[model samples]
Target: MALPRVSALRASVRAQLSAQCYHRTFHGSSARTGRNRASVLVAGGAALVAGLIAGASRIQRAEMTGARVPTALDGKDLESRCSCFMAPPVTPLEGLRSPDMKSRMELLIMETQAEVCRALAEVDGGASFIVDRWQREEGGGGISCVLQDGKVFEKAGVNVSVVHGFLSEESIRQMKSRGKSLKTKDGKLPFSAMGVSSVIHPKNPHVPTIHFNYRYFEIEEADGNKQWWFGGGTDLTPTYLNQEDIVHFHQTLKEACDQHSPTFYPKFKKWCDDYFFIKHRGESRGVGGIFFDDLDSPSKEELFKFVQSCAKAVVPCYVPIVEKHKNDSFTPEEKLWQQLRRGRYVEFNLVYDRGTKFGLATPGSRIESILMSLPLTARWEYMYTPPANSKEGEILKVLREPKDWVH
Candidate 1:
């Protein structure tokens, strides 16, 4: 359910009360006394105050019930009956019924989140995810699911967030850097961001950690114009390199992209490589998969289908690797190496990732959801180095120079 729009409620109440007061005024004597007009003014003022109090009471009831009031402006026309979804659709169902891209994206991510979670649970054998459905006061809300200390995964978080609100000046400036000509009124422009993001940390070092996100963004100017874009990527960060596994991962991504355009895989792969680089360490976060942003090109429907393909490609891309290696034996030293790699992951997300920065800067941003990508644990050592001939050293070399995994 959505957060109740008190402003809208107030407007409705005001209109109704104002109509009644005005109707009486119209039907009254044509030559009314000044005293009568003053009385009428006082009555109007009292009506407004009463309307405000009534709106406040409704909002309070909603909060107390942990639900929202179904107003004519909201839930009435919408129809949502999908029980398999992780939560109630963030966008109104009526809006989703149309050819609206926002609603489509919301549905896509919700379905993706459910599918991903169910697949992971199947692999975990018994460990189930804990789901939290939360609403942001500003506009929308999200469903967050986590499975910690599972049989196969150490920690995994699959989250779907749908939020709409005003963008801060800094956020607009960042968007402007992407070549978006954004104009705001009163230093704030309405915007919406919706996405499905997941990070899977397998208990086994050989299994690797996987992260992927697919999102749609819309920013509206004061003149009632809006700009929409789609952005997302799927990437792998392995503690140790498995050539066959990496090949399969990239191949799946390539297949997804290939279905859209030949240029997609190559262009987005390079973008992924560049975006995930750790400048200070002179290494990429992991062997790159594919990353692209500000993708308002080609066509909206085409791009949406492309993102859908990529999102659906996730299960086939990753689950096989986990199934094959979940029980692979490893030494304590190798586990420590995995921890070290996780520390690097933490570094990339916290210090360099734009998503993390924006999430932190946004109002009402969920801290746990924002930082959910971090592994359950990590180790940062001073000037740590593996033996040149070791597998750990080989992995570092791979990170330093990303190979054409699919090729």
Candidate 2:
């Protein structure tokens, strides 16, 4: 059984309650005294709140009882489903592979993917590409790229996404209570869709892992479809925070955000802080960059333009950063510490991530790729303590309480 999208669930429940209240008040209106109208209105409003609370409680109970909520598909199932989609056309990965490829940005994506892949391959041995695509059981589909074993990065791949689908607002709300919410909407779940990319773990401590994604979504209404937006950003994580590397990473990302809007850097930086938070630890995964989810008000075309801007910035933001550290040597001790930190990363994914749950629920998903974010090694020392005020402890402090980098 899988959980519902929390925001949609909440919105659905709220909408239902609102409808019930409106119906009761209008129906119960008195012809004689205007006072009766007010009375009914008050009662109806109270009933709406009561109904929402009751509905939420019921859903929670059903889920706790493991009342089988049909899952779309898990990771392994998704892989097989996606492979079937690709069997017919043996299009080489080098060309335009996405459906909406007529745009100039799409052309650039082709060149970027090729050039980036070439650069990455040269840095380390060529990455074994794990590419797959599938129609989402929810509404749309997307493609994922995963590269393992590299000279600069231990493992890294940028997952590009394209999707469109519907999730009830009530479902989204329930998902949040369960800590699975991402950048989704409030009110009734809009007829929504998105494209995204996210990278998991990197091998070298010096290489610093990174994650970036950009997507667009829209909401539909009874009168007319309304509201569309673009969202996503890049962030950097290092086992050791080299001041220069941190500066370079943020500066590059700031340039990207600034190019779109001056307000973007601060707004998205805060969003990243909030979005990438490891809720269990009450801290962020690393020094923040720009991260935003549901960005609406902008026209779809405008959103796409912003998406292209962000996407184009990715290679510049990260490849150079990787180039700087790919050759840095590390001792076995440093490698071991890197693995230890990976345990925290795993905890965030398994225990709190929406992606993990979604993948587990989706049929025919690929477990290995879903879990590829996991480090090659990990450690958990029983009741271990680090020396106070040491560099090791400095990193630990930031992990304990996330820092605001741009601020």
Candidate 3:
């Protein structure tokens, strides 16, 4: 089935909100005393204002847009003009072709979050997601949907964010170090980023934990040049070895890739294996699926379609496996093993995961949303070992030595 057109939905929501709201942009400035200050109205709420303040670091010294104002507008006016209550639509990039890539990608991710969460709720049959809507101070916000202690899933979270802001020189340098060629006249880059990220931890040890994220990023340069790229992948982590499940997972991802490019599956599968490797432990994080970054190729339209294809494939690839093993019986010992494995998952995220690091470092990042990928529970047993021939041991072998699941 085709994904929902969230762009239209977004427009509809904006129309509803517009009738009840007016525009007020909070401008931030760094005074001569080197103290950062922002003119903000508290009409919406403290939390909304706080998010904008946290994100205010991106405003440059000279780019302050509005005059300082202390008090919020009186009563009804204050309530009407606050920008904090609603997420502003992303400003469309000028000179771009027919379909606005920024809007298109953002809608796709938002809709995917809704689709995935709905499907997961149906599969869980007992728990529904609680949605948290938050706005970024800079420009935009997101919805974080989470379900905990479900019949099928122990903890699952799917979050979608659309944010645009100026990138500091330090941030640009970091990206350049990672092979991103970003340039700006005033030593700062204006950027827009949007994506859907999810991680699922099933109640049954037989059901593997799965994660997937797809994102689109654009950086505008000083010379009026704009550079854009796409990045994403999915991977599986299981406590017990099941070749059929692993094979099906890889094959499903491969079919998605093949529809876009014959080389995508193989290339990205290897990339996933490399990207998710826990270098210190000398092991792969999971049976790799597909991962690719900095993808700007045939055309924006083509890449957008390719990304949509991959997003659509996620449900089919994972739901069946959850259905097959979610009811399977397991022992306390098996549950313990899963906890230990989750410990490794924690190690990788805290130590080596770029997303975790980036989110932590980002000025306006929501800590709760960023860390939502972590499992509800985890354990570390010093010098623990499983029987050499046990199911847990078998899975460890594949993790230690990554496999070609679809071969």
TM-score of each: 0.80, 0.63, 0.76
- For model 3, residues 1-407, the per-residue Cα lDDT tens digits are 22123334333323432233222333332232431222222111111223322222111010011123223233233222222322222332221122467755664575467556656766787465655566678776676767888788999988878878887565677688789876677676888888889999998999999999999999889888999999898899988888888887888788778877899899999999999999988888888899888898988777877788788767767877787887889999999999999999999999988878777766687788899999999999989988889888898889998888877
- Cα-based lDDT at residue 159, candidate 1: 90
Please, what is the whole-model Cα lDDT of each candidate in the order they appear?
Answer: 0.74, 0.50, 0.70
Better of 1 and 2 by TM-score: 1
Candidate 2 runs further than 4 Å off: 1-116, 135-140, 164-171, 174-192, 219-227, 354-370, 400-407
Any residue pairs clashing in model 1, and if so which?
none
Residue-wise C-alpha lDDT for candidate 1, range 1-407, written one tens digit per residue: 12123334334423432232111111111232431111111111111112112112111111111122222323322322223344456665556665477876786787677667766877888765666566788888887777888899999888999999998777778788878898789899999999999999998888889999999999889898989999999999999988888888888788778877999999999999999999989999999899999899899878988888788778777877787888789999989999999999999999999888888878888898999999999999999999988999998899888788776
Steric clash count of candidate 2: 39
Estimate the lDDT of model 3.
0.70
Query: For all the candidates, what are their Cα RMSDs to the real structure?
Result: 17.2, 22.1, 11.9
lDDT of 2 by residue, 1-407 (tens): 12233334334433432232111112242233421112121121111112212222111111111122222334332222222121111122322234342222233333234334434544555444444443445544444444555444566554433344455544455445655434544444444444445564667776677776555545555446455555567777778867666666666667656655788778887777776778776667777778876555455545555656566555555655566666678888788777767776777768865565655554434465467566666787666566767656777777666665544
Error of 2 at 186 (Å): 19
The order of the candidates by lDDT, greatest first, is 1, 3, 2
Off by over 4 Å in 1: 1-81
Scanning candidate 2 in windows of ten residues, the lowest lDDT window is: 57-66
By the lDDT metric, which is better: model 1 or model 3?
1
